[model samples]
Target: MLMAGCAHFAGRHPLLGYTEKDHPQADTALVVCAEQEQYICGITGVNQVATWEKFNGGKTPWVRVLPGKQVIKLTLSNSHQLNRQQVTIDDVQAGHVYRIDVGFNATLLTASYTDLGKMDAYTIHMPRFPLSPKAITASF
Candidate 1:
């Protein structure tokens, strides 16, 4: 079931200098196409305005309104921690609206944020991939 709200991110930052190979779980994560879906996969406690780490535990997908002018920071966890991972986007201008899509498990999530603070978070549960429709070949 897709939870209809802003949810938290899970796991640690690909384990430092991690690559696609390092991420055994990457395959388990929903496959996302940039054109079909828009999202940013970030780690919590990694990128914070206060600190300088870029990869931490947890995941946060945030939309930037007026990026590079007035930025907003977001963090997530796997129901264990809260905003522990500090991922910060700096110099986000104040005006332009952005839609960020995050891929996790069988769900595609989103978060709306700005200089003010968190606005809302929602989830779009994804259906099984390699769609059954596409699996069928056209006979015509």
Candidate 2:
């Protein structure tokens, strides 16, 4: 997994596999903190049986953050096809480890929560192209 992260961080970020949404080539550059964790949640309904259950099973997935430095360079791959983009990582911390998640317009997904002062998902957006998992390149 670390090797894969290094490859993605050092080598070319892949764009060959993914569900293309709007275009054949769409991507964004992202800078994120890397951390490892396992999350599990269980909920019981009125019947007292475990109705809702989910677990991360002690897995690590890259999560995004606001760049604390001035500008962090990232290589983004197009979502539909093979491509790359150069972006600035704004308001994100440097050398800090965080669970990073790379995806398109993540802010929109949790806008209501953010506005309501709840736990909100951090996100970054690019004008021409947004960040997608297919374009994420990182070193864990």
Candidate 3:
């Protein structure tokens, strides 16, 4: 899956250097993608903003991150509406690649990933993906 995302990114950014070969020394790296769907994703940590993908119909590139056990919040928005889901993976380890697969359909929100082939198919208990955070935050 690592190579798959890398191949798709042809002329995007040089920072898309995400592979199973070389990794960060101390901190873990994060790569999030919306699969089988499209959504505008906003990633936030504590009070810091990480990244966001708007009208993302495909998977996103890898996002480098610090090593720590923290709760990273994500708000996904789409054309229809918006939704929010906070996901916490295991310990963020160094030299490891953390991939997040997000998707949504008519009924269920699908979020899952593998930790360097260490973890199995872990399902994220969320309402749905393809979620647009715009409408939701606007409600506030």
Winning candidate number (lDDT): 3
Q: Model 2 over residues 47-94: C-alpha lDDT tens digits?
A: 112111122211112222222432222222223322222223343332
lDDT head-to-head 1 vs 2, winner: 1
Candidate 1 wrongly placed segments (more than 4 Å): 1-60, 84-86, 92-140
True-vs-predicted CA distance for residue 59, candidate 3, Å: 11
Off by over 4 Å in 2: 1-68, 78-80, 98-140
For each candidate, the alpha-carbon lDDT, in order, equals 0.27, 0.24, 0.43
RMSD of 3: 12.4
lDDT of 1 by residue, 95-130 (tens): 222333233444424333333322232222322233
Worst 10 residues of 1 by lDDT: 131-140
TM-score of 2: 0.21
lDDT of 2 at 39: 17
Whose TM-score is greatest here? 3
TM-score on alpha carbons, each prediction: 0.22, 0.21, 0.45
Ranking by TM-score: 3, 1, 2
Q: Report the Cα lDDT for candidate 3.
A: 0.43
State how far residue 53 of model 2 sits from its true place (Å). Answer: 41
